[model samples]
Target: MAEGRSVSDMDVDDVIAMFPKIDPFLIRKWHYAFYTFFDLIGNNVIEWKDFQSLIDAIGAVRGEGSEDHVAAKVSLTKVWKSMTDTMKKDVEDEVKSTSSWKLHVHSSKPCDNRKTEKVLF
Candidate 1:
């Protein structure tokens, strides 16, 4: 995490293992940080893969059923819902401009509710 920490001088697992020996609280903190980072990267990667597969399938749209359309639309919604308001509009704009994947556009408008809005992303 330090500036100019050479990759060759580091082994992430080794630093992570040092947590328990250093402090129990430090271990927990390390775990929380790592898990959050891991989950973020994992989710991004998964969604990217999902979009890639969906795009690959788009070429065979002749075999696509109504459910396929619904699923694609829902995927768009799920992805957009995961972003912030500023990014949400950017995504929606991109979706509108991308002619090839117009079939996957979602209708869910990001809302600014008075309650129950938590920062999931």
Candidate 2:
């Protein structure tokens, strides 16, 4: 060891001792292997274990009280409103055309009246 030089030049232990109040950072998925092989830790990152823990934690939160009901609640009010509109349109069309237009105007209602129906997209 050289005299009058900094501790970083002397040993790895001296360098680690300088910063003793920090948590080791985690890397997500493949980054864990990077940290392990490089003997290094990132400042702030999500490791694979952390992500899995998050997924498990979310599942645990969702499963509270009713473990059998694992259904994710989504707001389908918009979808239902659209369906109601479509149904209303169909009903109005049925009332207007009655079976008389079958011999005359035929398919011109702006809606696809095929039995299979079509997706707008």
The lDDT per prediction is: 0.36, 0.29
Predicted candidate 2 versus true structure: per-residue lDDT over 1-121, tens digit per residue = 3346542253333322333332223112212332332112232221233333433554687774344223321212232233235434431222111111121112335462332122111
Lowest lDDT sum, 10 consecutive residues, model 2, at: 95-104
Pairs of residues clashing in candidate 2:
27-47, 28-46
User: Each prediction's TM-score against the native?
Assistant: 0.27, 0.18
Over 4 Å off, model 1:
1-62, 81-89, 92-121
lDDT tens digits by residue: candidate 1, 22-74: 44444344334323422233332223344445544653583455566557657
Clashing pairs in 1: none
TM-score of 2: 0.18
Regions more than 4 Å wrong, model 2: 1-75, 89-121
lDDT of model 1 at residue 49?
A: 40
